[model samples]
Target: MTLSSSDSASLPAERLGGLLQSASFHPQQTIALGISDLAEQAKEDRADKLGISCAEEVGSVYAAILGAIVHRDAGLAD
Candidate 1:
């Protein structure tokens, strides 16, 4: 998934890997829902911190994480 400028600015590089790894422990549907919640939180955080909407950034992050999860599951199913 593409990282928006705001996402790169807000989320540290190292933390991204950790977030993905931790999320893998959960079910896909649960992970998707959690990502939605996280995106909303990120949007709120970015708006509060930078006074700008970060919908695109958060959406990018959401898609990236979901993609990773799906890819991982597909690999495991093979």
Candidate 2:
């Protein structure tokens, strides 16, 4: 199951992290899909936390790692 963009953006870091971890433990395709969904959600709206900057930073790192993996598999990674 995938989360809606607004829903994802509003999710707490712990919740999002848990979902991401769950996706990572699944098949590679599932991980890619999860990251893709999160990326789009991030673009639309960032999570509103007490430490917004920290949340965004952590989210970006997750995106970067997942994106790198996807790009590498697609022969697009440098």
Candidate 3:
């Protein structure tokens, strides 16, 4: 789930912060998978609310963002 600079560029700081906060409520291993699932759900919710078809793309971006956050929190990132 490592993201290139470009891949991470479009992630909103506020959204990432919200995900981080949500992840904090779970254990480390669970947080990783949970964030991914949460991101997918968020993507679907946003797409439905906005009448957009970009859920897949949004989910991918959020997955990368959340993965980076989880890896860093687990002290697995350099």
Better of 1 and 2 by TM-score: 2
| Candidate 2 residue pairs in clash (backbone atoms < 3 Å) | none
In candidate 3, what are the lDDT values of residues 1-78, reduced to their tens digit? 443567445556665555456655654654466467668988998879776557767988999999999999999999
The lDDT of model 1 is 0.66
Residue 46's lDDT in candidate 1: 75
User: What lDDT does each candidate get?
Assistant: 0.66, 0.74, 0.69
- TM-score head-to-head 2 vs 3, winner: 2
Pick out the ten consecutive residues of candidate 3 with the lowest summed lDDT: 1-10
Candidate 3: misplaced stretches above 4 Å?
1-53
**Best model per TM-score:** 2
Q: How many residue pairs clash in each candidate?
A: 0, 0, 0
> How do the predictions measure up, each by TM-score?
0.31, 0.33, 0.32
Off by over 4 Å in 2: 1-50
Using lDDT as the yardstick, the better of models 1 and 2 is: 2
By descending lDDT, how would the candidates be arranged?
A: 2, 3, 1
lDDT of 3 at 32: 69
